[model samples]
Target: MKEKILNEAERLFWKYGVRTITMDDIARRLAISKKTIYQYFTDKEDIVYQVVNYHIEHEMIECTRLIDQSMNPLEEMLMISDLMRRNADMVNPSLLMDVQRYYPKAWDAFLQHKEGRIITDIKANLQRGVDQGLYRTDIDLETMARLRVELIQLGFDDRAFPNNKDVMTTQDQLLHLFLRGILSEQGFTVYNTLKNKEYNLTAYENK
Candidate 1:
């Protein structure tokens, strides 16, 4: 029952803005009484908080697994980035839009927490890349890493509006560009090969 309510709430909260959704709406959508929902959650705010927390926890676990340091840093970054882009609908950016649009406090908290975590992750991976000779030296790895991380987040975020289509900078392209900037000659070739590799959905292994 709790899972059902949360699942429905996650959908509703994403489809509609958080402030625009109410307890009654969740109950109605689930075909359950408000009283039943209240048993699991005290109020709409409580549910919203739970939904956000749950999403964050699930994403963090997936992210950690995908960003393994034992693998090549660039490869790790690419695979994790693919996971983020391909799974955006399951991610919280859709719900986060509502938070950003309405709940300023929640938005601020979300940014402070999640963005900080990502920065730390990127910075660490970048430092590892330098140590492993996968990335170039002489550049400020911290700033460049932060920029790449922000670009990835913005790419997935529908909030950053741009007018260009083909030449338009997407998160993937942004990532490639960032990688190109930091790559050694050898790394650059490897990255190009990765980009040109055809994606295969039939067997699901080419990405």
Candidate 2:
């Protein structure tokens, strides 16, 4: 029951911003009484915290899985980019803002995950790319990694992009730009091939 509530609440929160979702909304969605939700979580804040933690854990595991399965550092990044694109498509533009403004605990947990594990993973990937001669050795790995990490959260800032499509477009453009800056000649060749194939497939599907 607890897991069910968490899953449903996460869905609602992602689709609609967190501040707009009341406990009653969750209960109603689950076809259960408000009291039942209270039994599992003390308040909306608790649920938000739990949901954020759950999301972070799963994201970390997914990133690890991608890393393990990918043939190279660049492939791993593209896979993660696909993951981020899918997540952004589902998420409300104001969701992160709502959590940052209204939910301190949940926001802090997200910050910790972003600053700690995410940055670490990015640094590792950058180093691997450098070692494989895929990325420019002249770049500062730490600074580049941190920049990429912040760029991920920047996509959620509604004030900047305003529209969801604009946000996605900016993110995609920024990612391509970043890759272009970091990729060595050999890496660029591989990236160009993959990107061309992706573009062709997307065009075909849209037709």
Q: What lDDT tens digits, residue by residue, belong to model 2 across residues 1-207?
A: 998898899889988979889998999999999999999899999999999998788777777777887788998888788777777677777788889999999999999988888888899999999999999999999999999977767776767667656667778877888889999998998888776333111211111
> Best candidate, lDDT-wise?
2
TM-score of each: 0.76, 0.90
Cα lDDT, all candidates: 0.68, 0.83
Score residue 44 of candidate 2 by CA lDDT: 92
- Regions of model 2 farther than 4 Å from truth: 162-165, 196-207
The C-alpha RMSD in Å for every predicted model, in order, reads: 4.6, 4.3
| Cα displacement (Å) at residue 59, model 1 | 0.7
* Backbone clashes in model 1, listed as residue pairs: none
> Residue 45's C-alpha lDDT in candidate 1?
68
Q: How would you encode candidate 1's per-residue C-alpha lDDT over 89-140 as one tens digit per residue? A: 3334445556766666556666776567877888888887778777887669
Candidate 1 positional error at 57, Å: 0.6
